[model samples]
Target: MDLKDRKRTTRQRLFRSFCCAWAGLTLVVRHEQNMKFHLLAAAAAVICGFVFSIPLFHWMILVVIIGGMLALEVMNTAVERVVDMITEDYHPAAEKAKDIAAAAVLVYSAAAVVIGILIFYEPVMSRLFS
Candidate 1:
């Protein structure tokens, strides 16, 4: 291909990447209700990070835990949706599968909560106590 053609192809590729990113963002926005609580928690953590001037390591841990919990919640929601679609009526096996997926999200959420409390409680308590 000529140089001009190569440049055009590169521009097209970049445009496609940008479009894909926007689409993914749109999907996240559309599914906000499924993960609203986790998003709220993440927002709270970010605000607290700025308010407390948390160190990099603490922020890193918070980010990892929050990301994991959000990912798990999203996966759980997907699994539940698929299961429901496959079996519209109530069934023991479907219930068990849905319960398992929910439990995974709950476990990650609990872990994230504990990490948040540990990371923020000291700063919060000092502010309140002193």
Candidate 2:
């Protein structure tokens, strides 16, 4: 292929990939309960950050934490779906895989909560006390 053709192909592929990724995200948002909860939590965090007028550094931290959490939840859903696809019947290995994936999200969620508290506690206290 000519250079022009190659560049066009690459751009097309990139656009297609982005479309697929967005579809996956919409699927999760529409069908996954956990993802819905994560979305709500993310929204709440962003709103609270604005309400508190959090610093740029804190905003960065919140962004990372929230993005990591949503990503992890999506991964967990993928894992669960793959496990179910592999076996319709109950299996210890499948159960373990699902549990481990879920545990990862759970651990990250706990950390996110702690980070949220750390970030918001001072601002909330100051607002109330002042």
Candidate 3:
């Protein structure tokens, strides 16, 4: 109601939001183990962007591909975990679901690889040749 109370409430809300975000990130990292690898790849892409002085557009594409792949992998991991939790024992439908989720990650990974090669190959090769 008062200015002081409003400021206090706003600070509390901001703290709560930060806590929630940290918790969510922890959950994703713990539950989706593959996230570590995706994160490593993203880090590598970022490093490459800086090292090569890639064009803005090229860097944008790299960021998008890396982000998209990581996002898809996270979703796939979540789906697989839920499905496994529902049915611990092997089942035909469960296998199909898990396989499909894995395939999605694989597809995204392949695309990311292609994009990486396209963006960096020339710069890399010229460095090597020189």
Candidate 4:
């Protein structure tokens, strides 16, 4: 192919990738209640940061926590879907794969919540007790 044609093909490929990603997100949102909850929690965290006037570093930490949890959730969903596709029948290994994926999301989410509490404790306590 000519250079111009190659460039056009590359652009088309990139666009298709983005479209697929968007479709995946839509599928997850439609089927995963946890994703909706996570998004709500993330919004709440951002609002809390604004309300308490958290510093840039704190905001960055929150961003990491929020992004990490959401990413993990998406990964967990992907793993579960793959496992399901492999076997509609019950299988121990498939169960284990799904369970492990879920556990990772749970573990990370729990840690994120604890860290958020720790970071916001003083500010929240003072605001409430003052």
**Which candidate leads the pack in TM-score?**
2
TM-scores for all candidates: the values are: 0.77, 0.93, 0.79, 0.90
Q: Write candidate 3's Cα lDDT for 92-115 as tens digits.
A: 999999999999899889888988
Q: Worst lDDT window (10 residues) for model 4?
A: 1-10
Ranking by lDDT: 2, 4, 3, 1
TM-score of decoy 3: 0.79
Q: Summarize candidate 1's per-residue lDDT along 13-74 as a digit string, tens digits.
A: 67777886667546765775757777887998999999988899998998899778777876
Lowest summed lDDT window (length 10), candidate 1: 1-10
Alpha carbon lDDT of each predicted model: 0.82, 0.94, 0.84, 0.90
Q: Which candidate number would show the highest lDDT if scored against the true structure? A: 2
Candidate 4, number of clashes: 0
Which parts of model 1 are misplaced by more than 4 Å?
Answer: 1-25
Task: For model 1, state the Cα shift of residue 54 in Å.
Answer: 0.8
For model 2, the local distance difference test gives 0.94
RMSD of 4: 3.7
lDDT at residue 39 of model 1 (Cα atoms) = 81
| lDDT of each residue in 9-88, candidate 2, tens digit only | 77786777788789989988899999999999999999999999999999999999999999999899999999999999
Candidate numbers sorted by TM-score from highest down:
2, 4, 3, 1
What are the C-alpha RMSDs, in order, of all predicted structures? 5.7, 3.8, 5.6, 3.7
